[model samples]
Target: MAPPTSSVELATLGHRIRHQRLSAGMTLDELGARVGVAGSHLSLIENGKREPRLSLLQQIAEATGTDVTDLLSPEPPNRRAALEIELDAAQSSTVFRRLGLAPVRVTKGMTDETLETVLGLNRELQRREREAIATPEEARRANTELRLAMRRRNNYLPDIEALAEKQLRAAGHTTGALTHRTVSIMAEQLGFELIYVNDLPHSARSVTDIENGRIYLPPASIPGGHGLRSMALQAMAHRLLGHQPPTDYAEFLRQRLEINYYAACCLQPEHAAVAFLQQAKKERNLAVEDFRDAFGVTHEAAAMRMTNLLTEHLGIRLHFMRVSGSGAITRVYENDDLPLPADVTGSIEGQVACRRFLGRSAFEEQNRTTEHYQYTDTPAGTFWCSAQTGTTSDGEFSVTVGVPFDDARWFRGRETAKRVTSTCPDESCCRKPDSEALARWHGRAWPSARVHMQMFSPLPSGEFPGVDDSEVYAFLDRHAEQ
Candidate 1:
């Protein structure tokens, strides 16, 4: 008798699991360990010679950095149906992509029924998009009309204020203390107040008080000022009539202030850092000092480029390191491929230390005493490089690259401290053999050894900083030479 035929569904699941694992640069043994299975068993499953149990399927999905549902339903999905589901998902959350589930499922079914279902879903999606698109324009027009009506309402401020004061007095406040300036000061202190103090250029001098149960602006006698006062008064009235003031005004004020500060930070240099990052993407290698000189900003600004690239654009988490002797470097930035533990030390001797790989020929030829190094370790293996920056540092700032090392690298070449050579001695060991202290000391000799990195995905258009991109590519390409 022939062997049992393998289920196509099981085959599909195995294929997807293998794909995700490979994409993540996980070895078969590593993946098997994560999934609680032997590598040989996983190989058989991937080859469709053995069916994975349900629990094993879950483990495979988790180990491969994918959703269990995605692994279970790995049949080729109908493209059109998948798109429709994706659009629906996007409507509810801006970060729908993080859901980690393929939106559509492919299976043997009724041909006409699937088509009709997809068609209906597509039509509904289009309707929703149309409504969403139209609502913003409609809101703009409504806002304009509302403003016009507000101007006409400004004539009633005195009456409104009188009524408001009466109510406040009823609620146990001295009416005499309710002057506009007093209220403005109180509102400023309270912080939750959203009262608009309109000082329009052409408008008359008036104070709009949208506080303490009143919607009023001091009325202006002149025509131009009257219209302006009316608008301001109208805005106050709308707020008073529509909603209650925040319960904790102080807290509200604090929150608003924080938000304002964040906005200011985002808008500073008018998005110059984001632009530079985008430009840097086009290039293979980037020089920090050159970028700062061109943009007229600080090292922090240039560093933000890399931060945004990794965290925002590529969805990668970054680890920051400030080596005691080495200035600062981005130690690690990785997606699912090479997830480093959060508590991993960002130092070479402590975890993974960076070693400058300056060529012997160049060092001998130039008699260069100091060198800068930058390197990253992924599951694929270690990558290293060096670069020159214009910024110079004293003993305060040293050039250094960040490296992620397991315990082995952290402890390697560390315990051997015998004075084998006579040329360099204790306290003046300029030519010490490869050791952790030697690496740290060499990094400190430079002004600033910190190398920055930005990790972002290629855009759909495939456009990036071509010159810098080429240089970076060349550096990576010449990794064997280094």
Candidate 2:
């Protein structure tokens, strides 16, 4: 056999050689004399400190009366050797090195139980380190990957559409806007009841009590316009979709997206949404606000629904953006080749959109009541975009829907005279400061930035991201009696 290249193989080979030599009733010196090497050299090979040549291995095998193949087997000679090998690997790991602790040397005095305990502690340390490492960067990477997958399919999910349609049909919803009563019926059909509570967990929008066939939601009226119906539907979606507890941050993100998709489908039944979009397109008057009013959903939700349906049903491609007041792109999707700004990781979220784009420019408009339209010429191509500003607890944000120049003819705002050009991905665009102003203000500005601490923290640790299981359980226990 060739010399062992990995430490693991070397350790295993050393253990096997030592085992065979001991079974042959020979000391290290006895074996070394028979194999033509010094006793100390043999000791180094036995301790896995150095690799033995193939010729020496063959000589040792013959002297020990064992086949070379037997000596080369991968299994450790005993459980003690296996534990020692595991400890050797753990001590050499990056996590171990980061601790700046000295490696624990294996000695004859160490017991198997002590080795097992140390290995258990190392495993727990590694797990905690991994949980801590699930930071915003990991979230961005996961979001970027999810966005790419959604983009490949034009941001449409046929399975979710079918599910929504099936549930709506069962709920006797053949109509205009989905009613709260209909949403309740859909949940009932799935063996779940919507329970309103004042003490819903702070971290959760809604929680499902699968054991009691109940979903706990905030105390909002059922038929009210506070998105209570959507919340209930999203909670029930977990059970309807047969979702398991998410194992990682990526899985958590995927489940959140899926549940949100299901909620949107329920809010605007796919068949009705497609027909509404089709008729709007036929009249060359497609507008997101009209769609939003027709479905009784928010402007942002309507824009997102358009992303889900336009390419799949109306045969028009588009992009969507939700930009914060500070110009950071909070949510984004594009299959229309719009040159949205992105970070080095291909993550668009948290990166600022160009001030010239409709997403940012709309925020500056005095007439925030109506959707603002703009034509932006980017490196990829020109896009006609419509943006509407909305305010939430987090402050102002703009929801934008845009399409390629050719597809603009099918929309209502194609004739808007607001046109601008952007050379984003270049510092001279909106990102760079004015040269003359910079020269005047150099070393004069000392403004403190508002740090978003949550962004720097690791993702909340639990089976469900951002949820506290103990609080949820206590809430459920309190409600279960009623």
Best by lDDT: 2
Judged by lDDT against the true structure, how good is candidate 2? 0.88
Q: Provide TM-scores for the models.
A: 0.24, 0.74
lDDT of 2 by residue, 166-200 (tens): 88899999988888788889989988888888889
TM-score of predicted structure 2: 0.74
Provide C-alpha RMSD values for all models, in order. Answer: 27.1, 8.6
For model 2, the stretches where C-alpha displacement exceeds 4 angstroms are 1-133, 222-224
Per-residue lDDT for 405-471 in model 1, tens only?
A: 3311221122222112212112233334567776778757767654533212321111211124444
Give me the overall lDDT of model 1.
Answer: 0.38
Question: Which consecutive 10 residues in model 2 have the weakest lDDT in total?
Answer: 217-226
Candidate 1, TM-score vs. the true structure? 0.24
Give residue 339's lDDT in candidate 1 (0 to 100). Answer: 24
Error of 1 at 296 (Å): 2.5
